[model samples]
Target: MISFGKILFFPILFLLSLIYRILFFLDRSFKKKRTLPSSVTISVGNFSVGGTGKTPFTLHLSKLLHSNFPSIPILILSRGYGSSGTGTRRVSENSSASEVGDEPLLLKRNLPFAEVYVGSNRYNSYLQFRSESRIPNDQKVFTLLDDGFQHHALNRDLDLVLLDCTKLSKAEFVLPLGLLRESYSSISRANFLIASKFSEEWEDLLSKWVRKYKPSQTLKFKFSPEKLIPLSPGASEVSLKDLSGRSIFGFAGLGNPDSFYSSLKDQNPSQLKTKSYPDHYSYTKEDLTHISEKSSDQDYIICTEKDGVKITSLIEMDQNFSKWFYLRLETVLENESELVNSVRSFL
Candidate 1:
């Protein structure tokens, strides 16, 4: 797979990584002050960059909090990756992906009871939500940071970091050099290290970290394929059987797009074709037109639920996308009880 392009490109990537680390060091040292939220804060973040199942895991955590402590209110904080505005904005179920980030809006829709807010200033947003939304004196409120491992501006009661075993199995290095923002040595800083996308092939690597870090808790979770619901409104439930022997056009804008395509292949589709956009990609009309042309012969078009929010919004304006559908991905934390117990003890 080595190419002359990569040979020249890798050196540039290495240089960029060096500069990034230096800036990160300076930023952390200069800030000096970290704010503590009024409510208990549990951050579900990743050491590297995007696509560590932060959104899905946040949703999972919200469910746990709601179920375990029915009286408490939960607040989710997100950076609103693709938002047009820079200031803090409250996300509602009807909010468009353009106003808030796609993930925040998706979170709002799924967790209708929870409050989800997006802004660059997480600490400010956290304070604003707390000041505005008052609760009973006895109820415990929690603030969950979405993809906020490096947000040193605020402190957390528990920091759940994710290590993508799929990508790590190949190589481990810093930033542009590899996927890590820092070295594996810093893995100990996290209260819990969650092994995301866990597989038998990478169990040894996870074991190595467990031995070295000896973190308070090391849990693993798998993102399994859930039911594929039709994107078209009132389209009815569709199952895996629908894709068998049928041509499928799968597309996603995810950190690990290949993983999604692999899942698509497992359905035993007669013909499988996929298109990948960069992480947090904003789909445009031209992009849809291209996909339409590429998948003209495809029987069905499917994407991840994250991508579905944007696609679904756009599809609402057009009636020609009857073949559109989105596959839901759920997380099953292996040591769920233990992890919950650990948090419960802290609370």
Candidate 2:
């Protein structure tokens, strides 16, 4: 039975929701339309609040675009949620996660050739790109908007939405109670739907959902991070052979820590100790101290590239903490030909 207080609260929530919808609709109607530059702006985002593999997908798209057109100028625009710097700032070798956000830092590190910028307003970042004349005008510039599905003012050329299988069934309820940031109907605006972490069975269900929603097109993509890339310069290139019979303390502060833990387990096939932190968590000295105290008995303490960046400043204070290493994960399109063909068709 509903409590008396909850009964009164439900009506207030309904009223607020009605007001929010009205404002949302009005905002959509009054929003300024900014035409995308001659450059193709492909936005990779999701309907859910978080943990749909958007960062990895954006990185994968950048790599694919770069490999196909080596000389083409590609720029990645991210909101840089936790970044300290304000306005449009280009990420560089010297940039830290605290300045450019952890995901943007990871992208810059992985795709050093591509230009990466972080700004709250994607349109402003695009304008900044256009204003820069140092880049050749003849070269085709492609902008990959990271987590920009909700930012309708920028007007993206392609809208690719990623959906995690784990949340597919539980996304019925709206935000706070559930993971969806917007109503399911909002997916109708997407040009393509990417059901990440897809299996054969999940693909079938995704197809059904796509048909029901009547999205422009539906494509199945799987998110498999490449075998751990060593973070340190000379980590001896560890492989399955080296991981055998070794005790490791795996830890990460990513959206999907469980996936990272599972990946490590697959490589070792042994019980591994793990510690998980909130997404994009900044590590304090106390946090490192805790990790060191808990992992004293382990052979090595491993973390994700996202977490690894935060530890850099920490290690400088104490040399004994240098032994902690990170595993870098790269996303690859399972079907290269299909992905390439799709982009080519769009171009």
Candidate 3:
């Protein structure tokens, strides 16, 4: 999706990208950033449009902060892109995906101890949160700003930017022209560079690219299979052993569906087939019906946590709920100790 072609439209897109760049620089020069009092905000985002393990890394980083700074309350701010809501709303485990958006609700469910809020303007959301909550003098908030690389209005203490190794080379142009939201040169603004969905295949290329930019630090991480979580209520937790030698019909509405299928394949399934949708896609009844027909021969139907949240209601109504499962992925950060120590010195 990021590759360029030798076409006339390419030049036109490049020209428009230049205009976008000018506006970006102007915004950076003129914009005033506001910081929340008693908060150390760490932004986990990327310059590209597609998946680069941003959400998983954000979750991992929040847990890291919680482990190191137990007394601090974790505040996660997100600009809920797909939700129909207008104002900032606190996401809870019981909250519907339609209310707070899928990712925020998922984060809230995963980190019940953390406070997750979604709104278009994160600065205003933080202000609203502060007005409502009673903070102790000794406790400072550890905030995780999700997908906030382009959110220049909010001041952040640390910027953690993720780049997908698989799409790094292809993303040569910015949005409208290519998959990247901004040019890779923008990485210089990042405090920490994260290479997500990493493998040895891109090591030399990644190293050369990193050497070119000389980021403060670079972290490598990959997704690993956690467990098979059944969609049916009161159903016992399924095992990878159960998944082994079984046919899988996997589907995902993610920035990069290939990454999901690749990880799922590692479970050693007998046969693997997949369907991909656009990022943050909302599944409908018609979509589920189509999936059901395609996956009729499959022993199990698998989807990512993101897709699972949106598909639960539809599957719950079906009689074959037992075959529905979501693959929970755990972010495996390499050289984690070094990163932890670096952050500890700051927070």
Which predicted model would earn the best lDDT?
3
lDDT of each: 0.81, 0.73, 0.82
**Candidate 1 — which residues are off by over 4 angstroms?**
1-6, 9-15, 136-139, 316-318
Selected candidate, larger TM-score, 2 vs 3: 3
Please report how far candidate 2 places residue 240 from its true position, in Å: 3.8
Clashes of each: 0, 0, 0
- lDDT of model number 2: 0.73
TM-score of candidate 2 versus the correct structure, residues matched by position: 0.86
Please give, for residues 1-347, the per-residue lDDT of candidate 1 as tens digits.
33466467988977898899999878767766565444778888887777777777788889888888877788999999877866988898888898898899889989987999899988888777777776544456788888877777887888898887777656566776667788777767788888888878888877887887677788887887877878788787678777889999999999877778888898899999988898878898778778888999999899988898887766645457778888887678787887678678757
Q: List the residue pairs that clash in candidate 2.
A: none
TM-score against truth, every candidate: 0.92, 0.86, 0.94
Give the better candidate number (1 or 3) by lDDT: 3
- lDDT for position 263 in model 1: 82
Pitting candidate 2 against candidate 3, the one with the higher lDDT is 3
Give residue 275's error in model 1 in angstroms: 0.4
Clashing residue pairs in candidate 1 (N, C-alpha, C atoms within 3 angstroms): none
Ten residues in sequence with the least summed lDDT for candidate 1: 29-38
Ranking by TM-score: 3, 1, 2
Worst 10 contiguous positions by lDDT, candidate 3:
1-10
